[model samples]
Target: MKVFLAIAAKVRGTGVERAMAVARRSIGAAFPVPAEEVTHEEWREPGAALLAWTNEPGPAITYAAGVSGYLADPRDLPAAAAGDLGLGGCYSLFTCRSAATGPTGADPVYHAETPELHVYGSRALLVHLVATGGRVEHDPLALQSMVRQGYFLSDETPFAGVRALPPGHRITAGRAEPYGLAEPTDLASALVASVRGIEGTARLTLTGGRDSRLIAATLHAAGIPFTAVTYGTQDNPDVILARKVARRLRVDHQVIAPKPVTPDDTATRVAEVLRTCEGMTSAYENVAPHTPFRARPSLGGHGGEILRGGFLLGCQDHRRKLDALFLGNLDLLTAEAAEHARGLAESWQPTPETLDHLYLRYRVGRWHAAARAGIQRSGLRIQPFLDHRVVTAALAVDPAERATQGLVHGLIAELAPALARVPFEARRWPWSKPAQKTPDWRSEPGDALKSAILGSRELAAIVRLDRVEPLLYGPRLPKPALVWHLATVATLLRPMRMAVAA
Candidate 1:
């Protein structure tokens, strides 16, 4: 088992160095491996300094700890607790100068120095840890004590086969269950149960989306004390609708504005965020390019996709019509590619095989696998949507009820009029406007040239190809491939020479 940790903090003169030293000492005491430190030069692009350690030929457990002056939302505490408690075998700690600046591209970035740590070995382990915010403690007596108090147990990672949580633990809503099986009333009751099970503060994510709104409504109906948070540009529909819903519920609401990402900064920042996420299910998962971590246990509404069915149901319907139309009209070349694509498409049909594959192959299965590896490496348990019962219910719902047009969850809103009243409107913000209007740089010749100069060969090697081939020359690439291409282009355009130097 190998363990790695990255810490970020602002430099407070000599005190920052002392803090780093102390953090290293604490980590070393908890793990058997020797730690290594890598300090960033002042002018470096990703300026965050890092300390990493790996354990080999030993137990698969890895521990990581990050300390920042920035205060996180109390709701995120469970995740923090889980990450910290899980420290054993191998450990890494990251100490930043200050939390005021948060984690910006130029402000001594961390994680870019290492990327492979983000891969999780198991999805179930990752989901369980993130959802509960609990880790397997080293002390059996202590673990037993926490369990007696109602903490949950978690063991969804690859390295360590088993993990335990203290009593009163709760999983995030989206990851709780499949979309359709649970009735609105049942979901609401589950939310209430999760809240009641926890001691002290709880945070609820409120968005214009029905799932979040429903959760908030349920919390209110249950008289649970919670802080509601919404993030986006001010004009985003979610921001607008969330505000309205918060007002109606008369709960405290906090709105986070989206940050701006220039062509020069996007790739590095995305990579860093991904590294921090380490245990996420999707390679595309990020904490919004601009927004820094503000609070913990950030309630994510990712389960909405399952609740409404996968995002591609409508496209599937459209393809079915197109297939009928083009039965004999399409050329052989197009037909061959379409044949393969069609099989992939048809695999998503609402059937036992499709449902099982969706859950095991993509949804929980893959997600948990990625998450397990990431959590071990980064020590950050990212619980996006880990409500199991809710997800199971969603899976049981008929496919017709899970509309591609966002009508399925919408129908649920109709069933619960009060839920429909919760506001969920998308709004655009001033800062985001410029980027939205800016032409994609990958289409520009200058960007392409820059890419060729800044180690295109290396990029090619990472991609396992002798040359950068045009997509038009081969079979159509998958969506993930397209995103990686864009990301590679972004990386080339933004040379980290200056950022790394600082």
Candidate 2:
């Protein structure tokens, strides 16, 4: 397992060398693998290119977290061309306008960053790559899109010029193209086999949901030993159902409740998350259950929704699902900003499966903050849903079945009846919302956030600080949403240098 950092641009210079240092610091790869063992590729002709091992990669094929793909290939590290790249799995640093040159010739500028190319001019790029490798600074439109439609929603990143590589496309020397994939196999069996391929005992995250239960059934059928865990408030049905499933399977189970969050603790934690993850997307997973399984391979239900249409109720049109999705979430923006967010949504292609794939790419597979990144913090986080086997099988399913996740439910009901009997966590959504708490919005966290937003001379110029105060205060929405948005605004607006210096 290896995770490497790659930087390529039109002209070779000190910027590339400096990027290597940033990569090491960014990945926290303290020990170099000795110069001789390190892999290096430099292409001088087409605007120089450079690829170096950043901290050793964890696995040769790190599964794409929220999508059906892999980062590095089994055939080679730093895949040679677009065809070799995985579908919708890449983040490159380069400067190429329309029609990138053959292998890419010297462009006007040199850019560098990871997860995705950060092209918000020099300061924004430096803050994300060097200041805090996790989150990137956004321009006005980017900030508005995030505040309203959710972060990482449009191909538009917070930065200008830098674009996300759409699912199924690859970037090679700044050249990008889509590659067709071979068909996948039996997803249920594939889930088990994928875990077996990893040399170790596996731990599963059992939830009051079809995805986790489905995986548990498949793993049980294959005779793989695993420990199941559920964490959150005790009253959460997911905790109860997960326990019931674990008991039926005769597997060890643990239920952990969330720890109390102090204002200072939250600020620091949120700061770290906002900086590491692509957006303000984050949740505090109880560390207690994870402690016992820290060293073992853990499996999650990431990307399972690819088989289920997302919270897309009332969205009838193919091309305008993005608009529906934006509307589905709460409104925390000015009328102008909300409209701007809506405009960004309209840019979505009118494909039937557009939202499904976009959700996978932008929300899940984009970065580490969630289970994808949690694996980095915890043990090896493996999501069987992202396995090619599951992806292939899922695509073959009829769209209608996928919409209701009929396939997943059927699989569980047949293979794991006990799990099927339990009430689903989502079933209560219509009648029940999580108890929303009103926090002291004018207190420490709020003041800190206010200062952060106001301090960012760049972001404040466009984003009206007046509007930010109202949307972030009490009664606007749920506490969790309010907390996260504050973290997002603060993290994105505050420059890394200022954050650190303060």
Candidate 3:
């Protein structure tokens, strides 16, 4: 994984050097790699500086994270073409608006850009703030939104004054502008090109689903050499179907079954996930399945659901009705959070394309973007469906045609008719089945997570510990997912609160 911090201070006496030093210390604490592997660059006139560190070879380009690309110089930001970096991967990049101005560019996924400082690394931003002696206050609305909806609404983060850039938009001179994507003339060719852009080995997380199957077909059609890896027991439908797909394509197939983790390791995994994701999303899986993809770039089928119109499919075509459908579940939200969610819902224009665009912007851009950021900390993931060309093609498809995954099926058949012939798994809402025996929430908290949450004053301030005493002694726990979500929030706030208290 690569970690970096970029700062652009235009003022002459703003202590730019001191700021960079603090940033380096912060980033070092998180990465802890050899000093020689870190690359440092500076500019005098505009008072710009960048510190990029990677475990791999060559001078690191900290300008962008999560995507493989080249950066000629820090000053090229203002004139950077969108395609300068390859398509269909999660990333955060810093581009300058002009020779004399701060850096600006399109928001890839998890990035924060202020007037003078632009941070490309996810949790590195939080670490920098603590090291620089800046205030690290929590955003109540954002915290509530995370607990209620498993993600922050709009552009807000759990931390005050920090905003994750919405995908497909660019920030220049601290202002946002639309960087439009044109629909691809040839969708299959675009998919092929996107996969070919990856630098090293790539593996597809093959599953018994329309999205992954479509990607598998494209890889085979293009003659791309890649492995299809599945996680779960052999009896699982995903594994069973994935094996058939790989056999049809005649590609190497591997399956990694889930293994139990010791209690100590479970705690450690939870903490790592919280820090990596920077508390922008939930931390449901305490013991992530081990896999070979952690060290290699993995190809995933993210953002493909947009082509199928999978978000709020049956809801009425009205803004308020859509709001009620998506944002009305306020059982866990605070009063302020409910209001903010409603405001965001009402802000959308009720055009014919509202459903698809809304999902693309919020669900894929914000939620999935954060999730991918966390996953990339361990390994790189290339999402071909998220490429600008593919997104444009998806948006241009007729909604009625995609209502039942018609677009996905047609694309797969066009790419490889034999692979499309295999049946895939489909489930209704609330995907997970009930556990054989429900475990008590009080006993389920891992040691590290329990200690971190119980000792934090920051979490106590946001959540009322007295009201829900019977319900695991704190924060609303309607289900196991909510429990993990609250634990993630606590773990993320722990380090920031510790730094402040010290």
Candidate 4:
């Protein structure tokens, strides 16, 4: 939460006043700072720092760490610090801005190279901040992991000096450990409070998914007026089920189709999403969903999986098989790099709590949150599931409630039985077929995909470009997910090309 602004740092050609405002609004703290002076809590440290946006007031850990709800009991920190840290209710992004002079003592300096952009930093800051010319040198391993799959084995970012603190884990005096995972309070009341907090022209995105449905039921019970919206093709399962949900709740609903897309249009939109996502995930055609909503701070369901065990629906729970299985679609990688990435996953500390923590940090935080960012840009208000109160409750609840999505079912059936009586639709798409039990990507080959892969310097250099011949010319690749990554990688590289041009 502490911000160290370099001397003469200007975010988007503005003084500290505007830059500081951007940072405050990002985390939902809006205290006014009248001058371009150092923040009070920041004075506890040497550099320009802002007090972290947290409810609990405690000593900020001397090591690189941030806490959200309850700072785990201090007695627990020393013992758990050595493992993969997942402090259940904390979040922090960190970097050591020194040149590569590894390990002055016990702690090695973390490399950070993201250019100064907004007061609130993000991956997309590069496209805007780097144009006039700050170039960030990325680690090769980090770049490959982001492009080939979705995340790197460690917390490394594309820019060398920057690394994020993995959730549920925090550092103290250069040591890292597992943040305590258990929360004493359950999530039911917290979730309801989250829904009730929305006021003044509020909106919700209702997919056929349980998270959205639960939120809808809660809103109905609370007597809150919200207009639920669904966007996709007319027959898409989300659209249809959301319709049933709206009708049953007796609330207003709206549907927004993707404006017609051309290859060029797809390229433009994909690049926009990549800018916000920091090239961590790909953009699909879902970009038009938010245009119809004029509401501020739209609600979304992000951490629903934490309660449902959604990430590993059927995959083996252990590390080896999960490593092989999660990376199954990325055949485009050369044998060598692919093996290294798999090796990393294999060694990943395996536990349900740890797995859930990482999934929330990377998959939902980076990939899903980034996708939502791509869709709404600045439109989305908040995702209650990711909130600190929500996280604390989820981590604290009994494990049995999470299995088979029992938590979701229990809450809805208890809160709004009529809505639950209407069975959940089995299909998640417009016209899904068994197709050997995989997502059906058997649509005719897309020219946009081929163009995206072939037209960029960054994609050509990193991927075994020669290995992608099948995708570009010879045959239809059956995986929609793989195609998406390729398109996203292509979109991320466009800015690199533009940097060259200007």
In candidate 1, residue 309 scores what lDDT? 50
* Model 1 Cα lDDT, one tens digit per residue, 321-433: 33432222122112333353344344344443344334333343333333333333332222222343344344555544564535544543543455564435454544664
Ranking according to TM-score, highest score first:
3, 2, 4, 1
**Each model's number of backbone clashes?**
83, 12, 2, 19
Candidate 2 per-residue lDDT, tens place, 135-254, comes to 334555666645443454654555544554544444554555654654556656555554554445687878887778887887777677888888866667788678878888889988
Q: How far off is residue 359 in model 4, in Å?
A: 2.0
Query: After superposing candidate 3, which stretches have Cα over 4 Å from the reference?
Result: 29-45, 62-90, 96-135, 198-201, 261-269, 285-296, 313-334, 349-352, 426-457, 460-467, 473-478, 494-502
Winner on lDDT (2 vs 3) = 3
Best by TM-score: 3
Write down the TM-score of every candidate.
0.46, 0.69, 0.78, 0.66
Per-residue alpha-carbon lDDT of model 3 for 232-280, expressed as tens digits?
Answer: 7776778888999999988889999866543445455565655555566
Candidate 1: segments with Cα more than 4 A from true spot: 1-185, 233-235, 264-296, 316-356, 367-385, 404-417, 422-502
TM-score (C-alpha, index-matched) for candidate 4: 0.66
| Better model by TM-score: candidate 1 vs candidate 3 | 3
Pick the lDDT winner.
Answer: 3
Residues 126-234 of candidate 4 have per-residue lDDT tens digits of 3222222333344445555666565443556555455543444433323445445444344666666555655565688888878888878767776768899987767
